[model samples]
Target: MNKGVVKMDFSEEKILETALKVVKSNIAGAKVCKPVLASFAGRKGQKALTIEIRLDSVKLKYRVEIKAAVTKSDKMLLAMTNKETGLPVMLMTQYVNPEMAEELKQIGLEFIDSAGNMFINQPPVFVFIKGNKLKEPVRCAIKRAFKKAGLKLIFALLTTPGLENTTYREIAVAAGVSLGSIDYIMAELKEMGYLRRRVDNSLYLEQKDDLVRRWVMAYPEQLRPKLTLGTFRGPEKWWLHGRLPSQDTMWSGEVAAHKMTDYLHPETVTIYCRPQKLNGLLLSNRLSRDPVGNIEILEKFWNNDEKSASGELVHPLLVYADLIASGDPRNAEAAEKIYEQHILQLVR
Candidate 1:
């Protein structure tokens, strides 16, 4: 079919007239509904037009929305009419943000430039995990495998035209993961009945019936806060904070440990610090360099300093003490002695 070029004189009525002409000219036995002007801007420095066209016939009923932005040149307006309807196009350097490109994709618009060098139909997958109180180690393993394999999986699915049948090796190479890992993950998923492999080795991920239920049950209720210790402007400064699901619940040391594990495990680091006690006083004393004297110092402020009878403090000095206690069995004994002589003396 010869593509029709419809031009309007930059008015609402003219725009609708042009769209109707295009529909009548190109589609056989199709009727054009009244065009809705989605957006129209013609003022100083910006000029654009966007319209939605609806077509209905015995065989097909579909809607096409078109947006054309113009500057000094009319190239973008012309390009909008000529470009293929639903294929992704690589945008030029002039495009402002990645989101404009994504918006085009969401609307099923393909936007290639003159050179045909770009495509942007990157499919996204939603992962659903099941079970409650799963181990941290297990979650880490699953996330790592997914990151390594996700891009390849999406690419393979996009390039492969039909769903007739394919092999595991084909999917593995396309997903860029070791065959062994792919096989292992697939086996685990299948045993859980979250996936199925056909006789032809085609693998499919099944959407679970109770996916949201599993998510609600598996979500963690508490998380640990983090402590940042650094030298700001040549003076030692320490700050501690953590985000909780809500403010009503006080932070817990065990929850903090789990949060630390979640954040640091990918980097292969460990948290060696303990929760701080008598944090505010310790900050003052560490600055003063005065002997805390004995357990009395801590005992005096224990009720005032504690978040509650049950809440734990994640202090910098406590972390340092924990590290010292960890390195040498004798240092643990020394820490107790130091606490009794200095920190406890102040509180008492």
Candidate 2:
């Protein structure tokens, strides 16, 4: 059972040939014509090719765009193809999974795969044929864009809710990642349809809840433990009343939720402090490291300006995610309250 990319080095001639065969065979009475290589204006400094074919039987021509696969990110390419050729846009590829046809249609492009599964939306003739797939199709791309650096930039956007339109350089500086990394993350978000760019080039989230849920789900599974510097046995008083690192320390988890909602009587105090002040806070509070400690010390993930200026609590979004991720019904209820008050009131 050998499985690999069937057409990694696919060429335009091969694609054009395959598409010609698929269309020729699919239409019973359609006469196949020659494939004409056509070029059109694309992104700046880039020209794109469209294979034009004349159908003698139907007396209509088709402008076929060739691609390896049509993933969600192909919206831009589809737009360019449509813009370049006012003729009906049909996509022919080496492979197309039946699942991706819907996403292609949403962007106003029709497709026919090498495997014979197809959806062509040209009018006066809407054709849909299924069940001739030769092999499992490949997904567009794989990336872990929500890891440390990406998470930092996203947290700034989601928590602040005002930096959505900020420049890439600003995001790179704040996220502490390279400009290249920011570009990658931005593409991933745009492809996922979670992030949207306005006409003014300002970016914002279309599904804010979806973004939060993804972060929260990944946080407990991945980011949370990395952030947990070391748990320690301590009283909640240090977070509430004692003299801790005032500027660098912030409370999260249950205590932070309670601060914003006042609906839950929290049993544990979740605290976050800058790394430079972590040892001092631990020494001053007489805290000892314990694997199952009541106090969780999280490494500060944001800068001073990113933290809340009016309260000791962390951002409302962080509080909500922490509580909701706890998997406790009571915590989930408190999370809703925090969402309504602090999260809604503060973040857009």
For TM-score, the strongest prediction is: 2
Residues 165-232 of candidate 2 have per-residue lDDT tens digits of 77888777765567788888877777666677678877767556435545654555446667878878
| Each prediction's TM-score versus the true structure | 0.18, 0.56
- What TM value does model 2 have? 0.56
Worst 10 residues of 2 by lDDT: 1-10
In terms of lDDT, which candidate is strongest? 2
Model 2: how far residue 222 lies from native, Å? 2.9
Off by over 4 Å in 2: 1-142, 236-238, 345-348
- In candidate 1, what are the lDDT values of residues 1-348, reduced to their tens digit? 111112222332332344345345544454645433222221111112233223332322122222222121122222232242232222221121345444444443333221111122333311111122211111112222123343224223322323213566656664445666665655544554445566777765332211111111111111011122221121222113322222222332222222333221111111212224334433533422233321111111111122223333322223213323223222333333333343332222
* Candidate 1 minimal-lDDT segment of 10 residues: 216-225
